[model samples]
Target: MVAGPKVVHQSMPVLDVQYRCVAKGIEETVDISAAAAAVAVVTPPSSPSFRPASELDLRESDAISDVALDVNVLPFVPSIRSGSYSDIGPRRYMEDEHICIDDLSTHMGSLFKCPTPSAFYGVFDGHGGPDAAAYLRRHVMRFFFEDTDFPQSLQVDDVFLEDVENSVRKAYLLADHALADECTVNKSSGTTVLTTLVFGRLLLVANAGDCRAVLCRKGEAVDMSQDHRPIYAAERQRVVESGGFIDDGYLNGVLSVSRALGDWDLKLPRGSPSPLIAEPEFRQALLTEEDEFLIIGCDGIWDVMSSQHAVSIVRKGLRRHDDPQQCARELVMEALRLNTFDNLTVIVICFSNEQQDSSPSQQQPPVLRCCSLSAEALCNLRRWLDDDRSN
Candidate 1:
């Protein structure tokens, strides 16, 4: 799950829920429509729910020009709150992994002069085996704060924020390196990593592979991470340059993702670089009252749901009862109803004070995007890739 921060200054206002799965399984090619219904939203009877936006509308997501900063806009930011749960969809064992840490930034603050109590969220979707995913879940926190060149405390300056971004980049690689160096985990195992770090009003996101992070701003979905598939133009170039070829959209006829953590078996010997990698892309956003929630999930949820559909569902849920956890449950159930046959894990983080006691909607609503396949799907997808080696 990708996630929040606390405000040190005066009052401003603001807002997630969890869902758990019972069965488990590995990779599969999915049709989201078959796994979930169309994107729908529920609003107060007086206020009509908006239709789902077919595409992400991020024109104003990162700009302060869109926000009206006034006396009504309190310096007091919404407290970061998070909830999460995992499920085994159609398999025997669950390989998806996640974390939600509200005190991560705060604990790291001990190293700096000022304490910036931030939150951390991540979702790891594993392939080959669960070992790599499990390892990331256990050690991600260390890889992020200890291994990377993070500052003692966060400064609101551009340079320091850049440092934070670099640290985040290094952290992802470190985790991959640790997995490669470790003997207990499988050498062929791999996983997609999607994480979010919230410091005050700043939200930073990093991604490797297909797990995704989506933010809800004013009931609209804004993508924080893009999928790295071998078929993508730049990603295909990297794979080809690094001596990997794509066949039928699969990397070297084996891996589906162009970038990822672990999968040591896919690389060359003597530290020679392999086409597959653990490097991550990043995005930054400024939080405002209009920003409502964040969703960090593996492919299972995205397999069946659209970003706007997910946002609409959560928004409608909050509009009614304001419970992030229950909203998560509804989304998972929706996927199951539609038939997403993969291990599912979702983390929901809220930015508003909307989850207090509330009423129910006379009508119901809709659900994030990530591309993770099941183990069986991975095997089948592998059969579609063509691996040719020239040394």
Candidate 2:
């Protein structure tokens, strides 16, 4: 076992005080605060309700015959107070990639022809190999900003919104096309991308494959993106329409996701076009005072935790440690604790709200617990099931 370098903890920043409503019902209005105590985000819980893995979606992965947890991922909870902040925690995937591109303070935004100096966050979960995910992470921002009609600045007009959407669409497609064109990249390698762009209070989330984005508006969990899995109704319909078969929920008996970047090798269609596509779907939101934090994670985390469950964990982490970075690390650790079989990566972005006081007292956070099957046993079961089906 090798020791990994220590992670530098965040020195809690003195956040500029902002306003948050004391009122409970914001169903009538959109503007709100991110502070957990000030606003009634979700039916002001009597006690923080943190459920385990059984309540949310779960996907069984190949069981591990040899499982060893890395010690480098030191377990620590950290936060960045005041303003917008982000953190990442990686767990056991050889191919998962996360990028935080914040150019707000630099002239890079203008140089890239972007309209705003907003930060970009992406989590790419790679399959087959790391090439596809790594490629997209390196070039996502370039494609997003270099394209024609990218936003110059914030415009209230609907036309500009359309243009921004178009730019994102073009960027995603271009990235996909680029992967297909790259001779060195393995055509068999593919990746699931979940990217979030923050412009002031507006959040534009683009998604492909199963990586998920969830916004903790107040205390309530709000889904910012949808998973594109092979078994999904719409996804299945499209696969069939494109002359693809889903053998045991696998796309054409090969991939599990219906949409992703790369997979040129799987583009071989019996009669129709390729079953896999790189086009991403978009979701937009206007952040308010009540929007506490947003989470972008690979399927490994979501497989064992619900949107609300993940939010509950982050909110509790913030209340106790007040650190988004630590909160992210905790999330990955929690998933690992639950015995997840896939790679894990989770990002938590907190929006700073107007604080009521200079030094806020730390609050006691709720406790949580979960269960999981050993990787070896699960893998054995999966193989047995597969053999049974095949025979």
Candidate 3:
């Protein structure tokens, strides 16, 4: 196993939590103790318990085999650097919100111990209003890390990955219920969420609705999330089976997307099997040297460009400037240029430390020019040349 911090759970009687929120191009830190407390009190759905390696019975030889296999065969852990940017686009008000934590260990502080090189990112696209997205942005830390009973382990193995995926699923469902319980948020407002987590070499992406995550490996785009639209075959089948109809491509002739959190107006009576769902689809990958970066964006970005097109833009931008922040801005600007109809949000996460030069130098060919000269100037030049020759 990779030598790193040992994972352990610790409770904090008093907590000081800080998160970065970006709104209208301005970032602010807000305290959400009340919201976090609300999340903490609500228990997550029952699932398999996440047991540490020490608790499991294993032979001494098995431990040695695991260590040898991991150290010798596993790929190197990525050095992550991420940045995000958002734009209102042509919309009157922005309904997209996002969060990026490059170092989860530092952000979470003493509440829990996380695997090395841990990071978390999420994008919430709100409809009906901005309340749902804003609410999720504020309470994301608690819902995903604290309330979900997330797994903790020093090794990134199959067991650990499975537990983490289960924890993330529970977190999504819990956040959906929490939205319904919050009195301040509108019952009709809902948001499509897409979240990505990075632990050492493992990268996990969970998505709902139209938001997408694309991984760039060796200059190629690898889609990590599928768009859950009412018109899609799988989603359409689900909606029909759930007694919901699709009219003009809208779910139940109401919402455009098939899955989302909140919208209690549709999912009313508390878990009665509605077409609209909060459950997310997951995708994961093992990071290697070929993996260059990851791009997560709202529907606005994807609606105007293909996954490969977006990856090419970001790859070119990174090579030109090696700045993830600038790459995110470029994506938003490009989407605007394409005349996207909704709010735009994008996050660019780079995996390596190597910095490329901004531009390459090239030698210019000699210029051939012809110009008219005065007779007197020409005569003087000739005389000077003659004098130099004579000397």
Candidate 4:
């Protein structure tokens, strides 16, 4: 007789057999397969959780994605009824400014199978020049993606939020330095940076200068980005402290806008309360099914159209089965219709394809949606630097 514990149980799946074995072995070795035939318990089946129905395009995506813009000529601007401006002004006679887009993603979580497609669509309305917007086009989106914690879990509290905010601030400052190094001809180059990024379910929107981002949630208009206008209370105070007086009719004695890039002429004094800064105001929002499309455009659009009016037209256009490109095109067309007389650009981003019934309400009157800044317009901004470049 052998002295040892009994082999109490065995479980088998496919080729493998597992058992609760206690060694009670004598010198005689028996076939182990028979030992596996002990008590085998069958576990009850359970259903797997179902995933949502919305489908994602699975084809491999490029780091920089390009979609052609629908170029339309506005023969008569007044015919477009969606916005306040009636004339887009003179037709341009120059080389077409190239508009390109690039995105980088982070895979920081289990659900992060692919790089979070941080999509960016900006409408830079270049006035003094395209350098500002062009600078942004080259660096802003990439800057945000670089060194960022991808798919960062929201469970992190204030500490994480602070880190994120600091990251963005550093990115902006880096862009400023990078611009100084890259472009010599356009030292005064500046552009309004209005960027919207979608990573998983989080939406981060950042802006500097007059460009704006408006979010349409549940058929209601929401301001996602704050316009850094000269008249904003904080901006006004900053201006006063900088010895820059807001002229009776303007943001300040010199510049019409309170906040901007490439206006190195407006930096604050050594001991000024609010330092001369071009840092972007940042906002983070959790995106849900209710969040519709996002509209980000230069001041040209926001100048002529109110946030609510822009939302209405975009919502209606979407209801008409307008794609993101179409909605963006229509928004630009509307701004031109209002006679904005400035560089016009619009980027409309549809978050999801799910549709819903319109809320019962009277259509509000058309407001304004003018915008400005362009990557190609930087050529003109170089001249401004020669005129102003204070240390």
Candidate 5:
């Protein structure tokens, strides 16, 4: 079994007393005290309930032999194709940003050695302002691949997974630090991040906020990451232990999420333990034929719909059109119809070469035809009409 990444707490210096905030290209000096007092009131969404995989019934024929399940055998591999859509739903400005790279190795070229058939995707949901999210989006590749020591291994083994996890954790922390160092981003602004990395059949997800990743496995919704909110028991305990309190489901009575990148005002005095940390929780899965696609979205979508509900919609869309981009658009429109109160962003990543239309096709109704009368019948009808007219 591969061990998870070990977290180390490091203190960071608090920002200066006055914070300069940049929103929509306007710069305004914000007092830290005032910023802390003004908290956005957002209704927390219900936590997702997922059934354990063991509880799912599997047919004997679907089971793989031990020999085929071996890592060296490579029984199944995913052909990834992705598309995304975003809308500033009900919000004055869009604060969500995302990235979808279908081919990572080819994109990176000779910058660093990467496994074949690699891809990367991420969603950043910002609060307080859009600066944090925008900054991360601009520098995400550098932070993950260039700044941090990302592991270079051709093999997908337990050791490689451990190394990748460590590297990704470091990258998250590095981004957090970079946000603080950036003079343009506001100290109070922060963004929740969820990222997915795919190397051949291995899928790894690292999340630090409410943004979620859901996998469609044989038409069932499998949650790939957990939402880190103050209402969650584990997160609540951690916040309290770090000298923070949750007020009305808000962490520290200010932020909605328990973990995020940036938000220097909440995390600083440069490394005493802070309630709002940049550490990301990791989840991994070995993909198989049953795994069809993945849905990564901001809280806007999840707030209005369940994971299974989103999966069903996307599955139906794929069956009808097999267009991931259209599926993403449908998701956003559905969220709007459901009246989500925040910005919306969604990414649909398909694993199969083509849409799998498993449902039986409906037969078209038979056509009805009109028949013409014969010449003798027409003459008889004409004579009857003439006799009626004469009478």
Candidate 6:
């Protein structure tokens, strides 16, 4: 990989201090001290009443053939976060949400016919315009699977994690550029992205903006992504240095999110800081049979529900014999019912198996598509998935 721009390191008092907060029912919030790191509060649910995936009685139908674990995506979206606001900026009164569940996913399953009994899914919440989310729907998966070091054969090794990280970084940069290109109607628009990739027993998640990815293993809900807010230490420092100040909880007194893609209006060069970056904070987990599925969505859903509450709603729906897609749809629908005014997108990918011819020559290498093929060409075969509808 070629060395790119040097990152300006942030050194501040906030980097070393850990703050704690106590709320009545919720556990105390914890602060992270690193500028390049995350401050997260992970509170275990109070009740053992939380169902574990292993403990839940599995319906006979839940069992599938070994091949069924290959990978299949199911997802849903809501027109608006909440109905109260007839208009959210110039976008629309209804929430402008976008989501995708592509069976022909990229990144994790590029070498094989499908992901290894694992699934990949994501949700994009467009803020300035639909361009950002639309870009992720077409690009994030390719980022994860692009590294030359990515193992062609599924073997757990340190290299696996490295590849994952590198891919995420590449994806973020590529997505940012893709959205900024003049191909879109609103090239300066931006969106938040939350995605999950499940490979065999490992789950790698990444996010930007306030979009979130939550996991329910056994029955407890676990946060797998960080919310980037202006109040965040690193974000605050960047804002201040860039000559911007937070006012009323937003970056530079404007956007509510700290990091996102395609905010050209925010990425100005002569700024207190470049509009907050869209670099994603990532988490990796080793999946087990206990991991049923995952949920990825925008802030609209998170605003009205906690991770536990969201998981419970989806879990109940799954128990009622809803498929992954149906579960996702229900979550978004319920979010709208609860009065969320932002766009809502949700994706649920249940691990399934599919047949594949493993002969080395028979394997099809993955292909990536881009407007200016420079980024995509460096990695692998570039294939344009988007049309040149210059509208």
Against the reference, the lDDT scores of all candidates come to 0.71, 0.67, 0.81, 0.52, 0.81, 0.57
Tell me the lDDT of candidate 1. Answer: 0.71
Cα lDDT tens digits, model 6, 193-222, are: 776655556678888888888877766887
Candidate 4 Cα errors over 4 Å, as ranges: 1-118, 121-123, 147-161, 180-185, 248-252, 268-276, 354-391
Question: What TM-score would you give candidate 6 relative to the actual structure?
Answer: 0.60
Give one digit per residue, the lDDT tens place, for model 5 in 49-133.
Answer: 4333223222333222323222444367788999899999999989999999999998888776767689999999999899999
TM-score of 5: 0.73
Model 1 stretches with alpha carbons more than 4 Å out: 1-73, 106-117, 355-391
Q: Going through the candidates in order, what is the number of backbone clashes in each?
A: 35, 18, 0, 35, 6, 28
Score every model by TM-score: 0.71, 0.66, 0.72, 0.58, 0.73, 0.60
Candidate 3 structure quality by residue, lDDT tens digits, 1-391: 1222222222232335433333343323322232233343444434455333223222222211112122345457888899899999999999999999999988888766767899999999999999999999999999998899899887889999999999999999999999999999999999999999999889999998899999998889999999999999999999999989999999988899999999999999896989999999999999888899999999999999999999999988877777899999999999999999999999999987435221234222221111222233233333443465699
lDDT of 4: 0.52
Local accuracy of candidate 1 as per-residue lDDT tens digits, 76-145? 4657887776788887788998888876745555454423547888999999989999999998878887
Residue 390, model 6: Cα distance from true site in angstroms: 90
Reference-based lDDT, residue 229, model 1 = 90
Deviating ranges (above 4 Å) for candidate 6: 1-115, 139-151, 183-187, 241-243, 270-275, 351-391
